[model samples]
Target: MPVKIRAATQHMAMFSVDADAAQAMIDYSGLRVCRYRPNRAVAVLMLMRYIDGDLGEYLEYGTNIMVNPPGSNESGMRALQSAGAFIHHLPVDQAFTLEAGRSIWGYPKVMADFTVTDGHHFGFDVTIDGQFAVGIDFRPGLPVPSRFTSKPQVHPTYSHLDGVTRETAGEMTLSGVRYRLGGATVRLGQHAYAAELASLGFPKRAMISSSADNVEMTFGDAKEIA
Candidate 1:
């Protein structure tokens, strides 16, 4: 049996960090300094172009980050505390608009525009819009590293036309099976698949379940899910 994919979408946004202002905020708050780009290994510009959606949603990356209170010693536990505060202050009123299109590689593409009030401000408002496409592929599955815990997974195996893109590719993993972008192979785990989706900005509260013959993903709101 093959796994079935229901819906896929994209989001994009543009943002700027006032490094000087952020530094001042850190100083005033007595918090440890943090960089706008927390994940130094990944290319911010490349991700911006690839993600291709609202600016507010994709602009900020990484987990909880915060400025330590002024005069407080920079200790690991204190830093974690500040991080928790940062999470508590996240902005929730962001909006996005998406326009559908196709990528150069014939993958589905969505054009998006995004904006944030102030990156330096805790819980700044943001807006975004973007497009995404999902389809079937015939790529081979890759092996999962042994250090991880969980059974291996595989890609959905089926052939049908849903008026989606005929040609599309991106990495996908399910049930411990890893699937290559544009390829139809899967070799990873279910948990890994769910984690990847969440990391990519999928709604965390959404339900992901599987039957013997199919995989199911359900979101609360249609607008948010698409």
Candidate 2:
């Protein structure tokens, strides 16, 4: 019997913010994806990160602003009035996940879970707490100005099985996919995951690329299952 092959494409983005800020910015309005073949599958994913600053900034008044207040405005003046000098260690870490059209199939599935320690320390006081948002906008094909950007007719089925465990601080295995949560350990997984990643021009250490820019990563550790 002759063998049949199928192909899929994906795009993704991951963003992070601090906890002291009153609100976070998410701009997914500018994203693009290209189709490799006429009938190949495609999808996109986006990840967001949020960090907490400190309690002092949180307690201070006039930290939240409706819009970008001018530096010479009253709001800016109030922000400075309550400002104080303090040092705090803030956590900076990445979170990964998938966001794409439900109709598209054969596209790579994405997942990410981890904990971040005090990744950075800032001497100056800065508010970090705030609302954050992650947005996704995916279509088909490269740069083009036309109606109905062609998409593959086929839709791939995804199996979101879960039963993995975090056996160590730097590693977590879920549904046969191993994730290197931290440290220098590298993760590996099935060919489907690897192939999807390669087609999207993802980084070598990525288990999956959650966006077009490959900013978010789900590190693939040694798998316990085939």
Query: Best by TM-score, which number?
Result: 1
Candidate with maximal lDDT: 1
Tens-place lDDT digits, model 1, residues 72-147: 4353433433321221111122223121112122212233222322222211112222222111112233444434
Q: Could you tell me the lDDT of residue 7 within candidate 1?
A: 24
What TM-score do all the candidates reach, one by one? 0.19, 0.17
| Deviating ranges (above 4 Å) for candidate 2 | 1-37, 50-159, 162-196, 199-226
Model 2: per-residue Cα lDDT at residue 210: 25
TM-score of 2: 0.17
Query: Scored by Cα lDDT, where does model 2 land?
Result: 0.20
